[model samples]
Target: MKMDCIRTTAAGLAVTLALCSPLVAQTATETDNDRLDNAWSDIIEGEGQLLSPTQYAALNNLAFQAAAARVCDGEKLDSEAFGKAVADILVDTETELTDNEHMQRNAAVLISFGTRYGLFVAEANGDNEKDFCAVATKLKAEPGKVPLFLK
Candidate 1:
């Protein structure tokens, strides 16, 4: 997590979130359940190429969530730094993005990240922590599908 990029991403996210999506904004037609369903649906849509704006947004958030979760679970290897690293992967500002040249990507990350974080915290119906730790242990073991952050 470079300081310069963090600053740039913060500014970009602030502007985008402020102008495009209000954190508390809700339509009369859409309920909280609807939004959650939409978020989950967006995640399902992410299984493909993940070209849709909704999927992109959801993935960004899932990045933040996964990074933060590993860090919070006391499996501290290098995952502590990864929460900030999500911004770097959020948008390749260095490259000429013809497909996503116009819109700000950091804002989508912030919005989706916050939403998923909330959802993760609100989940109390199951032993998610135990399940998450089991997966973390496997990733940390041989096979090693997950590289950095879960060690």
Candidate 2:
């Protein structure tokens, strides 16, 4: 009888946790995502130079992605696609500087920065262009979707 009660109690507890875990997990996920998003928003709202250490690496990821676009695109960099990417990642239009001159200048600065990083990626992958380009192509196929390599 004691063993039966213990089993029932354990099962009830498991069921309760299973039901409640999603709500708990969802809140945590949203909080973490919002934190990163707010950080990005703040960065975009002001001068874009990144100064502090950050747990979110997406800003740094721009360099690698930009480099991949530049080096792996072969004959010409897809400026349109890359520009869209830069805008999407680096600029928060709502918070971005309203002055046309400053906005353009900042955009240019980010492009130049990405180009520099592209050079770095290219230099580092001098012998690995084949593989790097392949990955870049895969990413381009599904802009926001998970890459096959990730799955």
Minimum summed lDDT over a 10-residue window in model 1 is located at 20-29
- Mind giving the per-residue lDDT tens digits that candidate 2 earns over 6-34? 44434432332233223222333443322
The sequence of per-residue lDDT tens digits that candidate 1 reaches over residues 1-151 is 3554444444443343333223212221232322344544454333332123333443333443364354446555455555445544466444465555425455555555565555544431133444334434444453222224434
Question: What ranges in model 2 sit over 4 Å off?
Answer: 1-62, 73-78, 88-112, 141-151
Clashing pairs in 2: none
lDDT of 1 at 147: 28
What total of clashing residue pairs does each candidate reach? Answer: 0, 0
Please give each candidate's TM-score: 0.42, 0.36
Q: Clash number for model 2?
A: 0
Off by over 4 Å in 1: 1-39, 42-73, 77-84, 93-103, 123-125, 142-145
Candidate 2 Cα deviation (angstroms), residue 16: 36
